[model samples]
Target: MAYYIGTNGLAAFSVINYLHAFMFLAFLGIGSTIQPMISYYYGARKPEMIKSTIRISELTVLSLGALFILIGFFGADFLVSIFGVASDTIADMAATGIHLFFLGYVFMGINFIYMTYYQSIGYIKPSVGITVFRGFILLILMLLILPYFFGINGIWLSLPVAESIVAVVLMVYARKGVMEQGTFERRF
Candidate 1:
């Protein structure tokens, strides 16, 4: 008998959580590079610099998302052909999963801006809170919600949907801050 059947379910959850953490880390490098620059420009109150950075980051992330989406859509068949799965249904399902995962990247780009906005103001707690909530709580909520209705497909869609919600909230908070008429002095 396979030993996994005897282990506590927590082990499986731990493994899954570790995988998620690894994936999150994989994106951190790019985020790290862009985040500081966003903050620097924002702190300096250089509206033009801030605008330029946001525009460039958005375009770059959009292009990356588009490339991945294209691969998942058009190249899905070709890539799956290499695995020797020998089952058309399996290949199709895999391709569908890939497509579903990348569908939310566009919204994710917008979310990045909001999250970085807090960071730019030297207010890291809010940004950290959003990231943690998105990675952990939002995922848990999705696990609960996705299974009750659309099954795995719901889980696949959860990330993008949750991210979009977070983005909206962050934007609202940011807008309020601007409306409240507070000013930040340049650190330099």
Candidate 2:
């Protein structure tokens, strides 16, 4: 990616990758928390408990995501400087990347929860599909296609766009499933 996008792109990536370390770990923890609780509730045949757990988990994840976006948007330059990247070009590029890259956090938390939810409920395909599509196929396709069209900004935007697309699809289906209002249906 650095080779394709050049020094500035690499710098941008480096900054986000560093900051992403903690956030990613936290998100993983939050995401992983859903599975056992969900599975237990599902086994107990307690539909209401399942719905409540989903709501609470979604709220927690999305709130954390929003916090990450706020951090990225406000701390971009400071964050870049933390890496000792003094060049204005590199700093600006990294800041832009932070601003854009953080947007993925917005959708990612929800996606993570969905993945675990699907898995806990024995819906193996969607769970694995979510992981593969965002982390692999969609992301790789974006990495290849976006930079060609939107340049470095395209690279920064790829994860967010891919996450958003998957999130939208999952959310729509989820809305019609047990998580939404009305009686719980095994939709999707």
Candidate 3:
């Protein structure tokens, strides 16, 4: 799709993708920190502690998400420039892609948090389901369907759309579990 957009598009996408990789790793770090702590608390039947851990982790992840949005929105040109994007068109496209793509970060962190929470509680099925849908299934669907109508903007939007959908699904599932358990507790 970037190639279809032109060399500038490809170049801009490359820069945005590289930065995205780093941001993804940072999100992974959040998962790594929360997973074990949540697991240990859950194992001990310490529901309060588990809740506290989740609260803290969610706050941290949300902060990071906000930072990503800020950087992507305000610093896109600078970020692209770091990748040696000299062409005005490439810089502009890259900057736009960064701004649009980082919108996903708003909800992406919550998806990660929920996925890690499910995994920590040993609810492997939902964790795997969320992972598969967000990382592959929904993404592929959006990539295939959206671009046909909206063009490159659609392609850029695919991640946010996928993440937002998965987040909503997970939130609904969590709410159902909470309703059954009566205290935001894990069902499994």
| Strongest candidate by lDDT | 2
Q: Which regions in candidate 3 have their CA more than 4 angstroms from the true location? A: 175-188
Model 2: pairs clashing at backbone N, Cα or C within 3 Å: none
lDDT of 1 by residue, 1-188 (tens): 01222232233223333333433443454466677887777767765666566667667666765665676568766655655545555556555555665565655655565567667767787777887877678867876786467655665567766766775775566544533334453221
TM-score of each: 0.68, 0.91, 0.91
Q: Quantify how close model 1 is to the true structure by its C-alpha RMSD in Å.
A: 6.3
- Model 2 TM-score on a 0 to 1 scale: 0.91
Clashes of each: 0, 0, 0
Q: Determine which window of 10 residues in candidate 2 has minimal summed lDDT.
A: 179-188
User: What lDDT is reached at residue 105 by model 1?
Assistant: 61
Global lDDT of model 2: 0.84
Error of 1 at 17 (Å): 12
